[model samples]
Target: MKSLPPLGDDAVVRLSRQGGVAAIHTLTRPREIAFAQCNIDQRTRICSVLEGCLAIEDPASGRGDQRFYEIEVCYRIGEQDDRMVMKVPEDRAPGELVHLWDKGEVL
Candidate 1:
């Protein structure tokens, strides 16, 4: 496993690279991104597709004291990341899941 650089999400809603390595991204804002990874050789690295992202002040996932929304997401593994991104929809608010659906990643 080659040590990959720290990938970051720009103002855009998507972050895309080439590799299947494991990486951690800071979701401080809302955005649209497709996570993927491709190995040039036997090595792998964390890959991502950052685009159409809109960082919301409110945390979508459970993180703050007042829980506004809580979602469960499951991703399907593909060549790089998962072929499909899946998640259990929660009726916590209006147009919640719809928002996710609006993005490329459906829940």
Candidate 2:
């Protein structure tokens, strides 16, 4: 499992108050990525693991006034033909890297 480059310096991973809606954003691009509601925990975990590579901001650290619980960035990995693929927006193309979310369980 090779890790891909960080999304960007302005990238933000938001945890919403309404139904725990999680989304990814950037200074130039808002809502650049969205994940399934159930995968929020998994996504957060991934961000924590890749914190060194991401531009994570903790709301508790007296950051911006965003109501979102915590802010983070997303990382990707290499694509494997055997894994299930998630559809990414055309504009937010993964190019040569595959998002960790794109790969479903190996089963």
Candidate 3:
């Protein structure tokens, strides 16, 4: 699998909602990448991912307890299920951030 480009300090993370769905996108100088899309039921996970990315972009703007890192975002392709999953190991996750395999379905 090809790795995604690292998110720079200037990366812009935005979250928008339409009805019961929420979408997260990251915009850099060259391109805008769709990070994740989830239903209202999965709001927590999507919110956490957005918070993490924003924290990484500007640490001082984030909560002091949150620790952001470069996480591997993956999609389950060609499968019956389609979802975007952010892989953050349990040990590395802070108390507020979701762990990699905790919910299984990110989107």
Find the candidate with the highest TM-score and give its number.
3
* Model 1 error, position 26 (Å): 31
lDDT of 2 by residue, 12-41 (tens): 343212111333343213222344433556
In candidate 2, stretches whose alpha carbon ends up further than 4 angstroms from where it belongs are 1-33, 36-38, 55-107
lDDT tens readout by residue for model 1, 1-107: 12223332221123221112332233222334323332322111112211111222123333322223222122332323222221221233334334543443432
Model 1: residues >4 Å from true position, as ranges? 1-54, 57-64, 79-107
RMSD of each: 15.1, 14.8, 15.9
TM-score of each: 0.20, 0.20, 0.25
* lDDT at 16, model 2: 17
**Can you give the lDDT of residue 34 in candidate 2?**
41
Worst 10 residues of 3 by lDDT: 15-24
Best by lDDT: 3
